[model samples]
Target: MIVRAVVEGRAVDADARFALEARYGHFTAMQVRDRRTRGLAHHLDRLAAANLEVFGAALDRAAVLGSIRAVLGDDLRDAGVRVYVVEHDGRPRVVATAAPPTEVSARPQRVTAVAYQRYLPHIKKAAGFAQAHIRRAAGPLGFDEALLTTGDGLISEGAITNVGCLSGGRLLWPDAPMLHGTAMRLLEDLDVPQERRPLRVADLPGFDLVFLCNSHGVVAVGEVDGVPLRQDAETLARLLAFYDALPWDPLD
Candidate 1:
């Protein structure tokens, strides 16, 4: 549940509601624990870069941080936070929202490949109808998530996660276009043998294990397109450990 919502360092008002309703902006979501978040700098940098692209202006990082801090305040230390830069009254505005914290799912997830791609896959848009639609449609099909792919069968990413295939003791990420999520960036910094290769739906059987990562948490994939994947608990645990070892940056 949402504990608080703020826009430009103040509670939601008419202008803030308009900005959110605009639906032509970008945002970043992260898990905040003890008033700190992991990969905070990367999250800020992502906002800046996306702001430049979406609004043709520089983002006020300090103001964005202020709104997030304002929403969290002293009473709320652990929560899920999202910082959005939206256009309102012909100017870009910052909106921050906080909710209960989230963690990686303990059970493995099942996903099916879908032949669909987003328009600007690099930037995480505020309202992605295609992704949301696919996610909702997945449940009725008896899948936990939808793995998006191109018409040519090239794997790109999940509806809300980045995918990695563990083959021969190495992690292989798809080379296709997709959002570079914060958790995936942190994972890339680890001292592991990982590479980017052109993966496809037909190549799922060759991998020994498959996992998904996002700002929320890391999770293992048990099946893809009805192809059963390896559920190597040791590998999944080791990957999560490497991610958790990263120091969390304070929200101050």
Candidate 2:
């Protein structure tokens, strides 16, 4: 369902595709509707910060936005977009790709905890083979996703989403070395009873609600490591409504 791809404000070429597929880089993804997206500022800031950390060079946020716009153009109003920053020919290059818009699934997800931590977990880098491998291995085992944890069994994050638990009417985000997702940050800005703390895999059964959030949307976790989780529909609906109600910044 890929719509189009652009690199450095131009159509992607063979060399660009090769560079993108093979090089190590970082990226930020979001759902764009009518040429607008929520948490646009957050995505831009993330690109800048990750650029600095991954490449040791300041990222040109304006250029990144331009690349995104280039791919979207005037007709492409709704799509799932990703902005990537990779080093090409001794410079950091921006790559933007667009695909059909995806909706947050209403069905609950069941995930299994794996003793795998992402290297430099804070930045959303392109080198994701390890986590992909773990996810592939877990898929045939009846798990929808892999919940990454530390060697000592502390929950860090999901393979592609941020994990949160509702306990005692308060939302708990694990304070571990993980990517602070755009959706998670936006949710934190809302008026919600939430806090950051260390979460352990053994404590999954004690929560009233468990959910996962990424740029696409938030979804409830039905099970973790074979432990059934309470799919609190009310809380999940409230969280999703709050996120959906956020203002969508114009891509222009």
Model 2 C-alpha lDDT per residue in residues 24-110, reported as the tens digit of each score? 889999999999999999998998898888889998888988998999988899999988888788877888888899988888888
lDDT per residue, candidate 1, 149-250, as tens digits?
A: 998889999999999988777889999999999989998986769999999988887777788999888888888868788877777778878987899999
Give the number of the best model, judged by lDDT: 1
Q: Against the true structure, what is each candidate's TM-score?
A: 0.95, 0.95
**Candidate 1 regions with alpha-carbon error over 4 angstroms:** 13-22
Q: After superposition, how far is residue 219 of candidate 2 from its true place, in Å?
A: 0.3
Clashes of 2: 0
Question: Each candidate's lDDT (Cα)?
Answer: 0.87, 0.86
**What's model 1's TM-score?**
0.95
**Per-residue lDDT value at 245 in model 1:** 88
